[model samples]
Target: MKVRAATEADLPAILAIYNHAVVHSTCTADYQPQTLAQRRQWFDVRVQAKLPVLVAVGEGGVVAGWASLNPFKERAGYRFTVENSVYIHPERRGQGIGKLLLEPLIAEARALGMHVIIAGIDSENAASIRLHERFGFRNVGHLPQVIYKFDRWLDVVYLQLSM
Candidate 1:
């Protein structure tokens, strides 16, 4: 698989990947599927901010996963700090697509002069937590039972990597 910057054409696949996680997994706490327009707007905002949105294209040019570096907070004080997000196609998890996506995402963050990259993982998502740890992200904080999803309280673990 090859990882590259996401294009407008990749939005549908990106949306599908995210909505799947929203409805079927604890990867995200969102309970409803997002609309295509919402995804479009999100892409626009990221582009306008000069942030990187990358996609992992596997065989047959299908998007296997995606990763991005987003502003950690709207405040200017957080400009140098970014949050990283990675989502893989449900059918293709455990095949290293995330590893492929993350390496470049971190490179992009550093290239952009970012000071730190943050990852907020669900406490139950050991796989994701391990992935961040492997990327040199250290556990910085954990919020216990801070989210409710799938009829259960969920904890959020925050990890940080200093660039």
Candidate 2:
């Protein structure tokens, strides 16, 4: 597998993975599937801001997973901090795709002079939490019952990694 920057051609695969998680899992809190146009806008914004959006290409040039470093907040005070996102193709989970996508993401953030990287994961997602922990991300906050989805409340665990 190869890890590299994402391109326009990878958007469909990226969108599919994200939408699958949106519809079938708690990896993301969004309930509605994003339209291609919406995803395009998101990509454009990131590109314009020079944020890192990377994709992991597996055999056959398939996009197995993707990761990105997004602005933590609009406030200038948060400029040095970024929020990290990783999404694996549902069928490709457990193949170390997340790990493959994340290592370089951290490096990319640090390369960009980011002060810290944050990961907000579903509390029940042990795999994700473990993945972040493996990279030395420490738990700094846990918000219980903060998200309503799938007819229940979901907790969010925030992990921080100083760059």
Candidate 3:
């Protein structure tokens, strides 16, 4: 597999992976699948900000996963901090695609002079928690029932890695 910065052509696959999680799991708090136009706008915002949007390409050039660093908050004081997101195609989960995508993202963040990278994850996502831990992200906070999804209250765990 090869990891590279995503092009516009990769957005559809990335949106599909993200929407699958939105519909079938509590990985993201978003209750509805985002439209292609919305996803494109999001991509444009990231690109305009010069943040990294990376994709993992697998055999036959399939987009197996994608990762990005997003502004953690809108406030000016939060400029040096970014929130990390990674999504793998449902069929490609557990194959280290997330690791491949995130490892490069961390490096990219450091290169961009970011001070910190945060990951807000569902508390029930043990695999993701473990993956972040492996990358030196420490659990900084846990908020109980902060998100309502899948007809239930979902807990969120915040992890941070200082660059």
Q: Pick the candidate with the highest lDDT.
A: 3
lDDT of 1 by residue, 87-142 (tens): 99999999888989999999999899999999999999988998999999999999
- What TM-score number comes out for model 2? 0.98
Mark the regions of model 1 whose C-alpha exceeds 4 Å error after superposition. Answer: none
Q: Which tens-of-lDDT digit does each residue in 96-138 have in candidate 3?
A: 9889888999999999999999999999999999999999999
Candidate 3, clashing residue pairs?
none
Where does candidate 3 stray beyond 4 Å?
none
Global local distance difference test of model 2:
0.94
Lowest-lDDT window of 10 residues in candidate 2?
88-97
